[model samples]
Target: MASGGSKSVASILLALNLVLYLVITVIASWAVNHGVDRSRETASRLPIPARIFPIYFPIGNNMATGFFIIFSLIAGVVGATTSLTGLHNLSQWNAPNLNAAAVSSFTTWALTVLAMGFACKEIELGWTDSNLRTLEIFTIIVTATQMLCTGVIHVGVSEAPSITY
Candidate 1:
């Protein structure tokens, strides 16, 4: 068993990681939205900035710009909560599913970059703006986080003695 100090360190790290995750996620979302805005601005077209996005797994057109719209809305709530209370987390009702949200978040980030990069003319596919690869890697990492947490939760609960009908 780990010592109390080590456990405390781990918990702190976990909390920090969650905060960083949400921060980076919101940043990525905004970056994509900015890309959208730039594209529209350059083309002189008007598109409503998405303010809400789906937290569910997005696929095909389901993973469309609509998802970003939903995300924008949710991010606003998350940001407000964090700004007001310095608490960075989901409710217990939603905590176990965070990894899934992360999946959608990173995928949205990647696709937004892709649309703005290869599909649009907002960013150069330079060394740093290698958004596709970066998003891909992030997606993989987030997916792994989901799987690991699922496994840990399964084993943890399996070892418990409680029986709930």
Candidate 2:
């Protein structure tokens, strides 16, 4: 089992991951809103006939941008829940019930990585911007920290009790 210091570090990392998740959520939301506002402004400037019967939606970005937006929101919820579970496990750090926390952390890590992939695909499809780039980088960093903390927690907890004859 890991020592107290290791447990504390794991807890701290988990907390930091949560904070970073929130930051990503905020930045992504801002970018989405900014994109929508720009689209609206451009639409308003169009000529009367073009505005009256638009042939296509002016989402501006390609298909991957839509996927990126969807996945990022999903990742935010999963990461938040995982962080809460991790904190709960830390509160009961001495218990031999590490499986749930470890599982949640692993799940969050996977989702975050997936979201990063979506972000990359969106960028590749021409959704490049400072905000999107920052979100992608931060998501990768947070996923790494979450995975490390999950490993530390698994090491720190004692094994589950086995039935005896």
Candidate 3:
């Protein structure tokens, strides 16, 4: 179990991560809906040959949009679970599960970094729409923040020496 100061710091960081996750999810949902509408409109204008040819099809946009949506959902779920777990640990204040809490934070940070990498690749390819791109940039920023907070939580909780090693 963590001390009072460590628990308080971890709680604040976890709450921040949770809020960022929610924001990222909302922005991603907007981007996905916008992409779908834009894709439909663009598809209607494409020639039959272009539509038939897989190479010419705008599949990259669809794929990126899907990635954004899926990762956003994943981030949200992970954040929620992490926050809930942190709350449970805080309530108990016994500290046996501090390592688990640290592991959870690390996992959240890794996932956020993964999502950011995908988003950056899509941005580099210039496949996303302007609105989607803006939202994605925002998501990236939020993810970065969440990642930082998780790092803090991990550091705060990992100092406990429950392991024999």
Candidate 1: the clashing residue pairs are: 51-73, 52-69, 52-70, 52-71, 53-69, 53-70, 53-71
Candidate No. with top lDDT: 2
| Candidate 3 CA-lDDT value | 0.64
lDDT of 2 by residue, 1-165 (tens): 436776788779888988988887887677667656665665687777645533212453454654566567678777877887788877766544466787788888888888888876766677555666787777777778877887787776654332345
What lDDT tens digits, residue by residue, belong to model 1 across residues 1-165? 323333233234334434434644654565566556554334344233322322222211223333433443344334333322222221221333333333433443343333333322211322323443344344334334433433433333333234345
Q: What's the lDDT for candidate 2?
A: 0.71
C-alpha lDDT of all candidate models, in order: 0.36, 0.71, 0.64
- How should the candidates be ordered by lDDT, best one leading? 2, 3, 1
2 against 3, candidate with superior lDDT: 2
* Prediction RMSDs, each to the true structure: 10.2, 5.0, 4.7
In model 2, where do residues sit more than 4 Å from their true spots? 35-61, 123-127, 158-165
Stretch of 10 with least lDDT, candidate 2: 53-62
For each candidate in turn, the TM-score is 0.39, 0.73, 0.67
